[model samples]
Target: MTELTPREIVRELDRYIIGQDDAKRAVAVALRNRYRRAQLPEDIREEVTPKNILMIGPTGVGKTEIARRLAKLVDAPFIKVEATKFTEVGYVGRDVESIVRDLVEAAIRLVKEQHGRQVRGRARAQAEDRLVELLSGATKKRKSANPIDILLGNRPKEPELSPEDRDKLVVQQDDVRTRLRAGQMEHEIVEIEVEEVRPMSEIPGMDVNMNDMLSGIIPKKTKLRKVEVREARKILEAEEEDNLIDMDQVYTEAIDRAEQHGIVFLDEIDKVAGRGGGSGPDVSREGVQRDILPIVEGSTVNTKYGPVKTDHMLFIAAGAFHVAKVTDLIPELQGRFPVRVDLKPLSVEDYKRILTQPENALIRQYELLLGVDGVSLDFTDAALSAIAECAWQDNETGENIGARRLHTLLEQILMDIAFNAGGGDAPEVTVTVDKEYVEKMLGADLHRKDVRKYIL
Candidate 1:
């Protein structure tokens, strides 16, 4: 983060996303500001807060994509939640505070994964030793005593092994270890003891802390099971990894990461922006917005792991605003999001770039998919232009879904080729998609007056 400037962040985003320059620039600056805040003195840093962003645009127009790509670029903990999924505090639906909890959970998983990688070598070595012991039958056997002797509080002891037998056992164990390291005993079956944890009872939409407490009180049970060496190695490796990790440190770092680098993308926020009228769903809409205000502004949320502070966490909210404008939101809630960016509707040229320009372009994806069946797909420039024009015409005539229309258009254009690629009646080994082929595949849909009735 300290190494990447705002310009570099935007440059990185441009590879996958086609347009929405304003949105990209706004997010880049916000991310860079986080780095800047970290360098400030403690007092000044504590005073600074994130200038949350609000993106106003139609659906499928790169609003969500910009936020998602930005989070991935920085490797931050991210969660996308629809505003409609939450309701007022007294309502039966999920509360807005759950958003912070979800973000913290993501942070814990991210931090734990990093720790796991750091300890993988040690964990593997320990697991290999355990596996060798299991294969060599070094585990102590329990003796079965008579019932009368057990009742009298007396038990027989096992005799010590002779030196010669002990030396032979050591040699056999060393041979097994050598074979195990060379991957020669992976298929050998062995019996191992595994601990089983009881499942805790859960109530719908209940706080997670109570479940944790209930689970902690239950004693773990162990059982022996026979498994192949390869499968057992995986199980033991995971167990060793868990044993090596310190939960206290994981929780502390996870909380710090959530406070500093977490990003919560609130989508469909316009759905919660209401007219603030009398009783009904509209009333709850405004209530939901009010509920989200403090979290975005800065507040502490209690999660199962620990209490997480949202002081410096970045919040990027997006909404189409087709039915309600941004002004409809409560004043206090709207004030939290100071930066605003309106993404432009995608154009035909944008569609063309989406199909051919990006690193994971739709055309390249299809080519790779078809190539798996020994079919070669080639698309001409004229064919790309025709396809983009058709997608543009469809969006203009019906629902404007932006670049997503290409998925439908391309799938329809190559349906027969994909279904029969490995069949007896497949097309030529090398298939070329030309302008005429595009017209033949999609011309009828483009020319139809009732575009909604024409399925792709």
Candidate 2:
């Protein structure tokens, strides 16, 4: 991440994406800008704000992919949210702040994993110590069973062990540990009590209310469980390691990581961009945009965990905006997102490139899927051309779903191949889809406007 230049970033994106050089260049420069800002002095750093981008494009044209790949490039906390989903349940819908909560959760998990890798040596030592304690307890308990008294034909025996006997038990404990590590006692089940974490949903504002109203009426019970030594060691050691970690520090570090490297992709922004407002859906839509505006413009949002400031967080918003122009958004919201990049619709050549050029091309994906059932699939150059042609034709006839049309076309073309793929050892199937093949598949049905509507 630190070493990658804007050009290198674009090069990386080019491997997966076919074209859309403008969008790619915009994101690449944005990413490099983050790196450049990091090199600046602390005094000026806080004054700097991220230039949030608003991507205007139709569906399935790599708007989401660019943002998604940008997140991966920097190992940032990335979250994608649709504007429509928020207005469904009024205030009960997932609060916009939950996006920050999710980002924090992602940061915590990422940091915790990195810390786990860092503390592996210490954790292993702690686990071994616990294993030794278990072995010692088992050895002492076994020896206290009084074999001497049983051999004497008198079952009576003292429960307490002498200090000398305890010393011998310690030696036996070491021997047991040696055997344990050697897998000499793998089948032996040792009962051990282990605590399990329960999923507790914290109701916002309920704590204060509950304490005042129901404190004396009820008490919360903690949770616990029982398991074997092997399982318990892993669980307890992990628990102990988390306890060893400073959560306040973790939170601070997580917030910093999120602030510095977070990527928020706001999808379907145009859905909420219209000017009309009332008691109907438009009111809620406007409300949603207003709510999102403050966060985008740099305000502190309170979450269940803590408050996260959105000032420096990178926001990449995308919308088809076919019905609504970018200017349709509220002025304040529009001002917050200063950088606007309009993505061009994919041409026939672009569609063809998408199918054949990318690492995870549609053709390659379909071939791999069919190959799973011992089927060999190969598309002739003509067949590939036919598939692309049909995809383009469908888009022209129906909704222009961009590259996604390839999915439907390929699925229909290989329906039989997918269904009977694993039924038997199939022969090598080479599909040659030329102009004729495209016509045959589409047939006269494409010309029937109503038929095309229903079929598509």
Candidate 3:
């Protein structure tokens, strides 16, 4: 994150998303500001709050993608929730506070994963020791049917056994250790006792923290089961890893990370933009916005882990306000998101670039998919232009779905080729898609006025 400047962040985003430079730049600067804040003195740093951004754009124009990619770039905890999925307090739907709780959960998971990598070596060594003990015990039980032979008696057994026999038992145990390390006994079945943790109940409207506490207090049940050595190693490794890490430290760092660098993307915010009638769903719309205002402006949310502070967390809201404008939102909520970025509607040229320019371009993706079946796909320059043009026309004629139209257009064009790629009657080993081939598949439909209804 410290190595990534604003320009570098934008460059990375360009690899997956085409166009939307204004939105890209806004997020890049916002992310760089986070780094800048961290460098400041503690007293002054606490005063600096993230200038939350509100991205106004149509759907499929990279609104959500920009926020998502920015989170990945900085390795920040990110959660995306639609505004419509939440309702005001007293309603049966999810409350807005769940967003913060969810973000904390993501942070805990991320931090735990990092800690796991750090302790993996020690965990593996410990697991190997346990596996060897299990295997050794199994070997001893097979050799002697007497339970007393396997169990330690008050008297020493060394005096009863001949020195030669004792030496042979030592060599046998050493050989078992050697084979265990070599993975030669991975398929050998072993009986082991495992503690089973009861799953938490999923009762709607229940406080998540209470459920967590209840589950923690419940005693775990243990049972014996036979599993292959390889499978047992994995389960024991996870258990050992958990025992090696300090959960108190993990929780502290997770909370700190969530407060300082977390990102919550509130999508479809337009759904909550009321028409100001203050009746029916409109009342709840305005109410939900009011509830979200405090969190965006800075507040504390209680989670099962602990209370998470939202003061410095970045909130990037997005809405395709085709029916309602930004002003329809409550004034307080709008004021919290000061940085507003409007993503331009995609054009035919943008569509062409999206098909071939991005690192994960649709054309490259299709080529790789077919290549796995010993079939190669080649798209001529003119063919790409025609496909882009078709997508642009469909968007213009129908719902104006922005860049998403390409997925439908390309899928329709290659449906037959994809279905028959590995079949008996597949195309040639090398298949080229030219302008003529595209036209033969879609030209008639492209000319029809009712194509939008069917193509979409």
Q: Give me the candidate number with maximum lDDT.
A: 1
Each candidate's lDDT (Cα)?
0.87, 0.75, 0.86
Worst 10 residues of 1 by lDDT: 214-223
TM-score of each: 0.88, 0.76, 0.86
* Residue pairs with clashing backbones, model 2: 383-433
Ranking by TM-score: 1, 3, 2
- Residues 103-208, candidate 2, lDDT per residue (tens digit)? 7778887777667777776876776666666656732233332545555555444468789988987898788779877877655555444444445555642222
Best by TM-score: 1
Error of 3 at 73 (Å): 1.0
Give the clashing residue pairs of candidate 3, or none: none
Ranked by lDDT, top first? 1, 3, 2
Tens-digit lDDT track of model 3 for 1-456: 456899999999999999999999999999999999989999999999999999998889999888998888777899999999998899889988889888988988989999999999999998887887687752232322243533433323323558887687667768888998887998999887687766667655544645566545544456678999999999999989999999999999999999999999999998899874444557878899998998999998877677889999999999999888899998888899899999998888999999999988999999999887778999999999998888878777777888888888888889888887896565559889999988888866576454557765
| Cα-based RMSD of candidate 2 | 7.9
Residue-level lDDT tens digits of model 1 in 1-456: 545998999999899999999999999999999999889999899999999999998888888888888888877889999999998898898999999988988988989999999999999999998988788876555476665676576877756879998898799889999999999999999888788755677555665755577555544456788999999999999999999999889999988988999999999999888754435557778789889988998999877777889998999999989888888888898899999999898888989889998888999999999987879999999999889888888888888888889999999999988888886565548889999998888868767554455777
**Winner of 1 and 3 under TM-score:** 1
Residue 159 in model 1: shift from native, Å?
9.8
